[model samples]
Target: MKRSVLFAVLFSLSLHAFAIDTKLMVRAKAKDAKFVGSSIGGAHIIVRNTINGQILAEGITTGSTGNTGLIMKTPKDRFAQLADDKTAGFLAVVDISEPTFVRVEVISPISRKNAQVHASTELWLIPGKDILGDGVVLEIPGFVIDILTPNTHQYIPLESIKSTGLDVKANIVMMCGCPIEKGGIWDSEVMEVKAVVKKDGQVFGELTLANPSRNLFEGNVKIDGAGSYQVLVYAYNPTTGNTGVDIINCVVTE
Candidate 1:
């Protein structure tokens, strides 16, 4: 009886020791742009076991954003590899005794809080199997919009608002930190940027923002002797249906 129990314990230990290293590559790609990589403070990656709520691996991606021509110009075929070895990716190697299901989460452009995107997916990871070469691309949809004028929670006098009006200016960029310019890659002309104004929680008007230079949109909002004003600036790409927004609240004191 003692020998049998000892054998059982040893077998169990052996079985548990038979763990294999599984590799998984995760990449965060902008909706209409390149991959989110080191230049833009690479994406934060988290890998967790769904069953036990245990974290397997966590780190940030490091590499280039990826090739522009291959990602933007080339006609992609099914299973065509768009990312090369230099492209940014977070490779998580987890040791597992059996097939385990995991949830992968990615927060991209980690440097920009206002433009960060959280995306996740679940998949089964087989022991000893590796997923690489453009594996599990998470698409982040939106622009990074920052309101440059009329700072949040700022105070302005009503006289100044009625005299010169509020100059609305914003800086907008892709999730990958790609620049939006006129007649260039990621064209600004194809995008529509505007500021939605509100006074005392009521709709005031909308101001169309025109691109004066690369990644800069400027416009003027006419305030009706403002009370409490809220400005919501947004960038929309109708072609790809990608959009982003930033908001600010300013008090127009008498």
Candidate 2:
């Protein structure tokens, strides 16, 4: 868990810093609950347009010299670290099409199993001159859960609301740094998965979600009237007392 080893990555960007070309010395958190300690072999790192979802550039972490010497020209002594360790340091180069915001997607192994059982996280990046400084810092979250209804990012349809109720679901998983179905990992059997309803940021009702799948839980809410409503999903594990929460906003109209 002590991924605090010092390293360097240098990008020769004088003015055209339109892409992520740098060395990464991973600086881990104080208590990273999801640290796997070893490189996530064969992980795919992608930099893309957040709005249009267009892929700008992509690279794969090979736990060694996949793109080290191929992309690195004479890197400075500060860029001495190699991409030999996935959980530690590496060289990453990303091309940005335009000066706009972007999203970095990391889909990596659920342990070293070819990353076939994979997990992903989307970290946002602002338009910058270069991908220097702290390098690309990405957090493989300890858990993953998001609103899975309406098949979008926290957006619910206005017409989908009926007088009876509205159903909202979420897919929750534990990032134990290993495969789930393989049994050597922490499971996603939530102790309590509840959807707390709030109107204009005021607390109102909370419903305990019912599990429809091993990794999915859902709840129903009947709205009297809605301008903007917030559905806060909270998932807790009694075994570890670890919790994960997410928020989704919906606007209902006639």
Top-scoring candidate (lDDT): 1
Candidate 2 Cα lDDT to native: 0.52
TM-score of 2: 0.44
Instruction: Write one digit per residue (lDDT tens) for candidate 2, span 1-254.
Output: 23332222223353355554432222221012332233434345666667898876666544321232422344447655323333332234444434555666565433433113333335544344454433554544444566776343344455667666778788765433322221223444436778988867887678998875566778888776656677888877676665667777776665
Candidate 1 segments whose C-alpha is farther than 4 A from its true place: 1-16
The worst-scoring run of ten residues by lDDT in candidate 2 lies at 23-32
RMSD of each: 2.6, 15.9
Error of 1 at 216 (Å): 0.7
lDDT per residue, candidate 1, 1-254, as tens digits?
99999999999899878998989999999998999999989999999999998999999989998999999999999989999999999999998999999999999888888888899999999999999989989999999899999898999888877868888889998998889999989998888889999999998989889998999998997776758888999988899999999999989888
Give the whole-model CA lDDT for all candidates, comma-separated: 0.91, 0.52
Give the lDDT of residue 107 in candidate 1.
90
